[model samples]
Target: MTNETMMQYFEWYLPDDGKHWQHLAEDAEHLKAIGITKVWLPPAFKGTSSNDVGYGVYDLFDLGEFEQNGTVRTKYGTKADYLRAIASLKEKDIVPISDIVLNHKANADAKERFAVVKVKPDNRSETISEPYEIEAWTQFNFPGRQDKYSDFKWHWYHFTGVDYDALHDETGIYMILGDNKGWADSENIDQELGNYDYLMYDDIDFRHPEVQEHLKYWADWFLKTSGVGGFRLDAVKHIDKVFMKDFIRYVRENLKEDLYVFGEYWKDSNSDIVQYLEATDLQFDLIDVMLHMNFFEAGEKGSDFDLSTILEDSLMKSHPDFTVTFVDNHDSQRGQALESTVAEWFKPLAYGLILLRQEGTPCIFFGDYYGISGEFAQTGFQDILDKLLYIRKYHVYGPQEDYFDHPDCIGWTCLGDEKHPDGLAVVMTNGEASSKRLNMGELNRNKVFVDYLNNCPQEVVLDEAGWGEFPVQAASISAWVNKETHLSS
Candidate 1:
């Protein structure tokens, strides 16, 4: 079976002209041609505004179908366009993963008087102010939607917290005071900042039975309406882990049992991630933020960084089966709130590490593949990524061998299975130009191997015992394949 690769199809700075969905529909064939088996689309629902990047989710039911957010079309496109894009992806056998932001709701339609207690930003568990009435923007009527799909009007009672006090003209973390209203169980949520249940805007209260049922209903409706094969759950660390696991189970049981679900835990420690996995019963995969941090540090530190230890203390090492490895993401891209972009010079090495490995399911960032726009514009690695992606789909296979003896230079090889005979060798260095004499297995003995990346011009003829020294450029990566395949391509 061919390897599965996912591509995050949008950047932080995609043009707000509302044509992204159309572009996706047009590019579905190209994406499949490039070996992308899945596409994680940006939030398809209506947001705070048409220009909102879908994270500021206003109405879950109004997926660019209503005019409540000053426009009928979202930053991507209209409801029709969004559906068409999903169809295109499905037609190409590509799984369309929808970004689901359920942690909070933004841009409420009206203000509702509610009693709340102001809490310290650093420590949400401690209330610094007395319970007082504040007119909070927690009423979401979604008038434009007019309860078309399901009349689920939200009020302040349904939420756990609100950030802005409209009547007092104040903005802070205000925990709503009501029956069963508070942050999610601390034991079930991240302990960061005492409790991290309230991320931003009006935090959703999953503890409420109505809220849980409503969201489950929404999930079913969303799957039916959007035709998405998978879900990229956003801000899961702040939500209740028990609820997340249950919600996924509910969706899969009622809808599709093979539904692909992954959450953006955004934690860097493998221990913290493991805790979440255990809490959620390992129902979904998590993006390897720890691995991304390693790439970021390696990119920033250059030669001083130890290349061999890149996978150390990462989810890839501890829980590779449930890890979605990526070098950079929308949050880690340039200028985003969680910005920690891997350096451009080091991307070749990072891409090689993630895409060529047999460990984790790799995701290619849109900003890295198609380039980022706006003030911090940067060139993309389209050419190199295309080469690496092709090699991953058709070449990478069989028994893997790791050559991480050196701190700055590391190499690995996939000895090739019966189906893919002329397997591949990969060598990379963070320091000077070098060669690593790696054994390519007896099956590949006496074959002439060439750098598929073409970064190095030399070719190596494997000896009778299948040992050949692979040459790589300084601070670069070379994906070596059989000479015959490289020339044919």
Candidate 2:
């Protein structure tokens, strides 16, 4: 089904227990029942430490199998548990997508003496100091695995830089000038800082052939080892654009199975995302960050926000197919790094827009669906989400007609065919209680329509001309589907 409905399964603030994967395995059937076709998991491999949230990548091969970093299992779970979770999800025909972080590697085994150069954080191109000797923790001899997979050892040569220098006892960006190893930073990446290629801890040099082979090996190995449907690439802007394109190509070449790869570029500009798609020849679906920003802005402005401006600079307006629309993610949740929490009151409205719409692939965030852990208990969409999912899975159908006319209220209708007889109508208002006159075509004429969202709390009946007046509450939304339409997928 091409993952029409995607669920980002894990949130960043989840309790640091090595039991998440097991819990996810148990939650598989519920996910299927809730209309989730694809589930995206966080980084499975071992990070800097046992409690590390996986973005601080350590060993790609170690999926909680080794006794490294003070624990045998990752923060998620052991290797066996991770596999069982995927298997459980697969048993219900759900495609499991794993997160891939390739920009940097963290938690090295040993320190090596090397010549280093410091660069400005604002301007990476400008070398702030000359190359000086520093003991950088860049050696990686995977003592736990005992070289089970590829025996290629990582040293200062495989990477271009390190943050902490042991000998010098300084904390800054140090460009590693390995002996006889030329610097490899000539890839077209984010042009924010002239070149924002280097992101964090032990930045992998994409230009190096050996480094390239190792990453390719890991991608293929990961796919083969876990049999994951595809990947959700993390921090693509920090890595070389060419390298990312090649990695996807490599994954496709190795796995003859249909692979769906989408990357998180995380830019607030539609043009930049479109430009990255054009620049790398990488057509993978990107998370619509610009659209999320608009959603966030609308949530902040409340009734004052114009409904017409919602789709102004969104990828769904232009590149619909290649856009993965989401309300919030692990990074965007409250108290996280990209914390732009959508206002709680308007969450149902936001979820209604993404889930019920026909354009773009909608992703239900873990925090939004299941509620954020402990401290942020006030969040989550509650009963409205389950109802919306049912609507998205069953009622939403056919060719759409837009009625983005009013600044206060906007509505659209999906003209259903003979199979799904009475199509759907959606009316959303950012201002005080309003109603919109919309045509549902002759097929639905004189039929009783009810707001599935219950915000309207009123039934609408169409006239002989098929025109109906649908009303919604202030700063809320109303979705009108056929009163007799049965809920089934």
The numbered model that scores best in lDDT is: 1
Model 1 regions more than 4 Å off: none
> In model 1, what lDDT does residue 417 have?
89
TM-score of each: 0.99, 0.96
TM-score of 2: 0.96
| Per-residue alpha-carbon lDDT of candidate 2 for residues 22-62, written as tens digits (9 for 90 to 100) | 99999999999888898999999899887888899889999
- lDDT string for model 1 (1-489, tens) is 889899999988898999999999999999999999999999988898888999999989987888887999999999999999999999999999999999999999898998999999999999999999999888888888888999988999889898888898988999999887888888999999999999998899999998999998898888889889999999999999989999999988998889998889988678999889888989999999999999999999999998889999888889989989999988988788999999999998999999999987999999899998789798989999999999999888998899998997899999888898888899999999998989998877899999999899988999998999999999999999999987887
- For residue 6, what is the lDDT in candidate 2? 88
CA lDDT scores, all candidates in order? 0.92, 0.83
Top model by TM-score, which number? 1
